[model samples]
Target: MTLTALRRDAPSGKADWLVIFLHGYGSNGADLMTFADYWQGSMPNVAFVAPDGLHEAKDGGFRWIGKRPAGDPKLYDDAVEAAPDLHAFIDGELSRVGLDASRLALVGFSQGTVMALHLGLRREVAPAALLGYSGGLVGADRLSAEVTSKPPVMLVHGEQDQLAPLYGMMMSVKAMSEAGIVCQGVPLAGLGHAVNAEALIYGARFLLSAFAFREKHGV
Candidate 1:
């Protein structure tokens, strides 16, 4: 559970909010931490950290599900299997930074998104928000039975993404909504299997609003 990570401290040197970025397969934490740069000016009070996946990928970077062929069902099963380690890192980092679950935001892409949903929903103290990009829900049928909290969620996907298509994102939305979680789905008109400027902006504003809502409602 002790994974290496990349961090960007808040400009104030004291963070009121924390954003944890989870990168896709074969990608490192540093790859997703670039989001911090785009939103730093807007959210001066926020700290960002991206943790490398549990295992290294064959090509380079890291992976959450271990080595599995492209269409393997075991990939999904093991993503759930990988939750405890990621959860450990999350809990440990939140304590190390002096923030509790209410101030934590999870931002995930591709395989990482699947873990975010699985772990966030099962946490005893719900995260402030869960934002997933380019990935669908894993073990959705089990969610109703296992979910302990229903944090606000945002799912963003590219219309032309063949890897993890838009329909998959919508299906995640449907699953979360049916479970009584507030969920939003955004589709980028022509984006491929990648995050763009628009996604960053949307994510930044969404994080800000999530924290604001938590403060206002005190939930």
Candidate 2:
């Protein structure tokens, strides 16, 4: 599966780190790329890439996999089938940009968060960090049996999120912790089903700490 990506190259002309942003359902790469501006100064040597999901939705949005609120087995199977393609796309992006997997991080929102957690856990070479907002672990029951990587994860969700409830976030943290993967979760009070300024700041700090980039560069 060939995925479309929007890239923000490092201003320093050398990227020591790479961040791949995955947007929420019904959104595209352009939506998440906007955050790059805020992160650029703090991570001048890091490149950002946001990729559009594979399937187009009726509301002019995209999805990595079809939704099935009824807990349909087929939909879950489709998501599993789609995972390899998404993983391949990541590999292709890394090769194209001349960056290895070690310097990379995965960030996602909502449905994209599902993809990030699912794929990032199974990757042969784990990413430096995984940051997810308004999302939970899909196929959580099978995570222990399937997980290959144990990278640190930071989960952020709004306490008032009706779309993907706060409980999901709590459950995800618990499951990941039991799986022996380092995990942190923050629930922003009175917030809704979207990323907030606080989430971004926390996410940035998590990424910086995971990669040790701030300390290395004296930032």
The TM-scores of all predictions, comma-separated, are: 0.95, 0.93
Mark the regions of model 1 whose C-alpha exceeds 4 Å error after superposition.
66-73
Model 1 TM-score?
0.95
lDDT of 2 by residue, 1-219 (tens): 788889889889988888999888789999888878777888888889999999897688788877755234564576698798888888887887788887778999988888899889999887888999998787788889999988889999999998888998999899999999999999999989998788889888898888894335421
- Give candidate 1's whole-model lDDT: 0.87
* Model 1 C-alpha lDDT per residue in residues 94-166, reported as the tens digit of each score: 9988998888889999988888888889888888999988886876777788889889999889999988878
Best-fitting candidate, measured by lDDT?
A: 1
Q: Cα RMSD for candidate 2?
A: 2.8
Candidate 2 structure lDDT: 0.85
Give the Å shift of residue 157 in candidate 1: 0.5
Q: Count the backbone clashes (under 3 Å) in each candidate.
A: 0, 0
Please give the lDDT score at residue 36 for candidate 2. 81
